[model samples]
Target chain A: MRTSIIGIYEDEKVLMDAFNRLQSEGITIADVLSPIPLHGVWEKLKLTTRLPLATFLYGAFGAIATFGFLYWTSVVSYPLKFGGKPLNTLSFIIIMFVLTINIGTLFTFITYFIREKMYPGKKVELAVPRTTDDQFTIVIERPHNMSAEEQKKINTLLKETGAVDIIESNN
Target chain B: MYNTRVRGILIKGNKSFSDVSRDIIKPMDDKTPLWWYISAFIASALLIWGVWGFYNTITVGIGTWGLNNNVAWGWAIINFVWWIGIGHAGTAFSIFLLIVRQKWRTSINRAAEAMTIFAVMAAGLFPLIHMGRIWDGFFIFPYWNTRGPLWDNFNSPLFWDVVAISTYFMASFVFWYIGMIPDFATIRERTASAVKKKIYGVLSFGWIGNAKGWLRFETAAILLGGMAAPLVVSVHSIVSMDFAVSVVPGWHTTIFPPYFVVGAIFSGFGMVLTLMIVMRKLYRFKDYVTDGHLDAIARILTFMSLIMGTAYLTELFMAWYSGSEYELFTFMKNRVTGEYKFAYWTMLICNGMIPQLFWFKAIRKNITIVFIISIFINIGMWFERYVIVVTSLSRDFLPSSWATYEPTITEIAVYSGTMGLFILGVLMFFRFVPTIAISEVKGVLKETSTLKSFTDEN
Candidate 1:
């Protein structure tokens, strides 16, 4: 039988408990969840990338789309003329350029949604629901072949580490 | 010890969480007074009707309002200058906050930025509306043509206006939205209804308060604010161009650009004080807005009043030194003995006389008094517009063609109705958007106490 790991934590205290239990019990952890980020979770998970690249790419992409779309619309198609003037007025292009910047930069907001994987109508399981305002989550996996005694020790450690509720799910 | 010192300064205004909740949500009920709904609906209705009126104004010709070859622009142009002048506060507020390094800017920026957008909307409408032939408005732009197309004269001020206003509006929108993301997350998490939660969640874009996100947010904000400061100044100077580029006696001056910009700020600060004063009382945000904000605004008023005073003096000096009879007569008779001389002197006293009182510590510090003083400044600034437009148009190069400028009844209705629209937009905005930035103020308050900092909320 495979078991999933779940911890109910209100504060950083239980987050610490989950970490210690995960380490001490050697429970091939399925996953750990909390409402907030625990202090050393990145060290625990071993994440090694920066988000600056993601932000930069999304923002620059927005600016370009803005300029390209307007230039095509005003300069290329249906250029307006008045007072014996040409259809494509360079002065009017300022508004077009500005519209692009506003629209383009605004579109980068979609990137954040994609990066978070939190979209409308799709709900993620509450690793710890309080993560919205407070508390952090740390998820670890428990392997399939853990002995019952080993499982009991992990449970005991979880209780001692301040996990409000420790659940082993049947995966 | 530090906590005690901070607490000591915290003037305990008696308000609870529910009072805040109730005070903010006071008008939310369907049992809302008949007058409130009636007023908003009627104003909104007139606004809708006014759109048609404006449509006629454009379609029928520039002849819809009082315009002749001598005075090609009237109410539309006047209101355009007024509304654009009004748009100054949003970028100005952001700049002032950035320069002073005010952390509380987060609490107030959203509401103020909305002012920028709405005012810009009203301002932009005037120019388009004044163009009369709506379809042909694009001719104002300088573009390449099929037949040696005549471009817009870059030297013309209107071109400059087009550049400045668009830049300011775009920068303001980006700056305003970026600031809202974090707060949107808070609303998303706290909102009870699934629909609201979902809406806020979508708007928030999964902004988890990671350290990395905060750094980039800061960088983007600083960059936007930096762009906006000079942009805001440029925008007004461009609006000034529509007047300064002209050959009219009072209008033909190099000093008009900087003078108009200063007057815009002077007027903008007054409007900010006027709104905030009421807003603080209505929403019980007295503590958040603080006397400090009002005081800062007052100091700005004093400085700008002096600048405007100098601009007035400089104009008079230049007109005399140039030795032009018409220009000299316009300045001397304009304020001293012209038919519109009352308006001119009223502007002088209101913009100059009232703000001089702010140089003192006592008057500027008092909210009730400062609010009154700001109203005077607003009147002065509006009259300042009137003086510029009416005085010049009423008297020009040829004495035989000179006629007094009078706004038609339709112009009066539309102008009054535009004010109605402005108020309606502001009232609706205050309702839909959280008027005060909830998270930002909470952030300030959090420093006061040890937050439980964690919860199993779900």
Candidate 2:
């Protein structure tokens, strides 16, 4: 069985400094929970993000598809002449622009949901009740091979890094 | 390196993160305030009365309105334009400010976005009922049907309006709901009641704030903001085309698109200011929706009023320069000197002149004066729509066709009802949710920490 140590931080500055010190000391961080996102923490944690590119692709696809729909419907599908205006005018371009943006934004949201593993009735393990309100929490899972001395050293390091409180639980 | 006076400090000084959370969340968790109840009651009464009016209007047919053959479009279109114009500032606050990286928008965007949704709801009702055949409203959308299935006229600006307004509503609604999920999670965590917790949990979609989650959320928000920014311009432009495409003298002009867009933003700000001033005071959110926000909005209003004044001048200049008798009469005689002259001058004074007072720093800062000016601007915007729709149509080319248009009791009741409905929506938002974004305010507190200290270490 492996045990995990949780540290609750009051200030974001303390949390970031602790994460850096732990990383330098070759301690692995399993997870961090925060009420609001910490700036630059993702880059520091070396997290890879494909959301930007994916959203961009979605936007491009949306724009092309919307433009195609408008063109196909207005110009080819059902063509009509009114007020002697051309079948294809610049006005429908406005409709296409709105639809492109709408679909693109909507798809980006769906991608976010999938990436976050968020959905209705999904079970979430809350580290602490206050984690979503005011507290910043970091979880450090003890490795199976870690010795007693190494575990003691990590405990001292967490305290030294200004953790407001610490809890250890077996998983 | 930071100013001691808190130049751009969104949350007030001397408040910690917990304090920010408590201040914002307290309103939601605590008992509903007496004022909120009173306001909601009034709105409900008005809404009920307006429903009665709407029912009467439907059953009695179009005869309930004073729309004669000449002045076919009256209070319904005017109210529609007014409410839709008010909704513009919400998207402008959330999307435009986000793209521009205006950090201060964090405080007001949530409520402003709510205002957008409610105002759109109010505006949308007018057009459906204006049809006099509200049941056939679905015919407006392009859909396949069994009968010869008459397709929508894509060229007609009215059809364009249906598409544009509906798109604006959906986009704004989605944007508003998604942004609230994180906050909903916070509320879900903090609340003691099991039912409330469960409801909020579902609404939040099990949001567990992690670095990866935030990264994706930020990317999505920025993309959505980019998409919504153009909508603020395009929606109003399409709505203006509804009038511009017509051959009516006052309504038809190339400048209507830009003119209406600017006017929509201006009126939208006016309504936002009116709501925010009261909200900041009632909700005790003075710390978040600070004086700096008011000053910034006032300055924007003043600048918008200046452009609106210029646009008005351009219209007059074009009317004179066109050398067309109808355009000249619509601008010079019927609008300025004829029966609807009161409305015309009121629009000029309210929309064009009153907002200039905001140019003065003292007036902009004075809450009382700002409130008064906002009311004036709101009145002026309604009158502007009225002057355009009524005066232009009332007196056409032939004098025999000229007839004065007067709104009946039913029209007035319906308009007032929409007002109540808008207020009711705002009240419900205040009671159910944190009027300010709690997480964003904490973020601002971090960003503004430099203002509290003179240290260069940060």
Candidate 3:
């Protein structure tokens, strides 16, 4: 069995301080949850994301595909003379640009949901219910075989670093 | 971050994170207000009237409208452009302010975005109903149909309008919904009702608010905002191209794109001002949407009004300088002094001149005065479109085509119905959602002067 320890704080700064102190003491933080995004918390967690790159890639593909469709339809498939305007022209750029945004936005939206393992009606079990309101929660998981002394030291550290409450559970 | 000393405190009254959430969610949690019922009843009545107009339009056909042979595009197109211009407000408010890092937008953006979605919905109805055969609307799309040579003219500005408006509507919806997820999650955690909790939970998409989620959320917001900024510009520009691409004397001008864009922003800000003023008063959002925020929007309008004035003058100058008799007749004769002179002058005073009152600090701070002026700006912008659409088309090159246009009862009903729909959408939004973005307000709470010491310690 693994034990999960949750430290709850009221202020984001105190949470950040507790987070930094735990890391310095060689404790691994499973996650930090808050109502609003904490400044520098993602960086502190050393998490890297390529969502921007994904958006760009999606946008490029959309632009190319949109342009190709426009060209094939207007130039190759069914070319009609539009008041002496060329069969293929820059008018396609507007449609291409708009479609690219639609694709990039929609694809990135789906990507974010998939990456986060989130969906409508997904049952969420918050470690601290108030984590979505005014509270900040820091979750740490450790083996149940860890000594009581080590657990007490971690609890004391959290309490001293401004954690209002600490709860331990085993799964 | 820049010094907070330079800007007014975004959220007033030294708000805490819990306070922000409680204050915002209180409206949602409390019993429905009576004023809402009254307003909603009025809006529904208007909507019913509008539905009658639409029924007549669909059943009776385009003949019910006031459109003549020469003035084929009357109130339908004019109202379409006007509503589309108004739709620009929410994105303009949220995306532009987000890019520029204006913290003041947090309180007002939710309402503005809701307004945008509703306004766009209303705007879209005109073009569909104006088609006379609403079922044939799918023909606007570029699909592989059996009609061998008719694949939705990829070169027509009208087709561009369809694609651009649809994409814009979808993009704005995505951006608005994405921004609301965290707020919805907050509502889910706070609501006492089990059913409400379940609904908000589903709406929130099980958002956990972990660092990784915020990381991706912020990245996605910026990406969407950057793309949407240009999309908003293109949407209106394409709508303007629907006119400028034509050879009509008043319509055919190289200046239409920029002129239309500036006019759109000006009118959008005008409508935002009107909605926010009423909202702030009704919802008692004085603490969140402070006077400074309204003043900022007014300042933007004042500046845009100047550009509008300049654009109007530029059009006049171009007409005289181009040495085209038709252009001169359209500008100086038909618009400036002819039968449509009332509309022309209404546009001039409402759009080009009325907003100049905001240059005074006293007037900008006065809520009643500001609200009235905002209404005038909206009316003025409508007249601006009217002058562009009706005045030009009513008196083309041939004197035989010179015939005045007036909207029939059906056209008037459809227009008012859209207003009713817009109001009802906003009222429901207020009743259900947190009018002020709770999380965003909480996020900015630390930046206020009262909390300056708190941030300094961090």
lDDT per prediction? 0.64, 0.84, 0.88
Sort order, DockQ high to low: 3, 2, 1
Candidate 2 vs candidate 3, lDDT winner = 3
Better of 1 and 2 by DockQ: 2
* Full-model lDDT, candidate 2: 0.84
Residue-level lDDT tens digits of model 2 in A1-171: 667888889888899999899888988888788888775577777777787788778878877886676666677877777788887877777777777777777787788888888897565657577888888877888778889998888888899999999888663
What tens digits encode model 3's per-residue C-alpha lDDT throughout A1-171?
667898999998899989999999998898888988875678778888899899999999999999999999888988888889998898888889999998998898889889889899887877677888899988888775878898888899999999999997562
lDDT of 3 by residue, B266-301 (tens): 888899999899888877888888887888899999
Q: What is the DockQ of candidate 2?
A: 0.54
Number of the top-ranking candidate, with lDDT as the measure: 3
TM-score of each: 0.74, 0.95, 0.97
For residues B325-412, what per-residue lDDT tens digits would candidate 2 score against the true structure?
9999999998878788899899999989999998787797799999999999999999999998999999888889889999998999
iRMSD per prediction, in order = 7.5, 3.3, 1.9
Pick out the ten consecutive residues of candidate 2 chain A with the lowest summed lDDT.
A120-129
TM-score for chain A of every candidate model?
Answer: 0.59, 0.88, 0.95
- B316, model 2: CA deviation in Å? 1.2
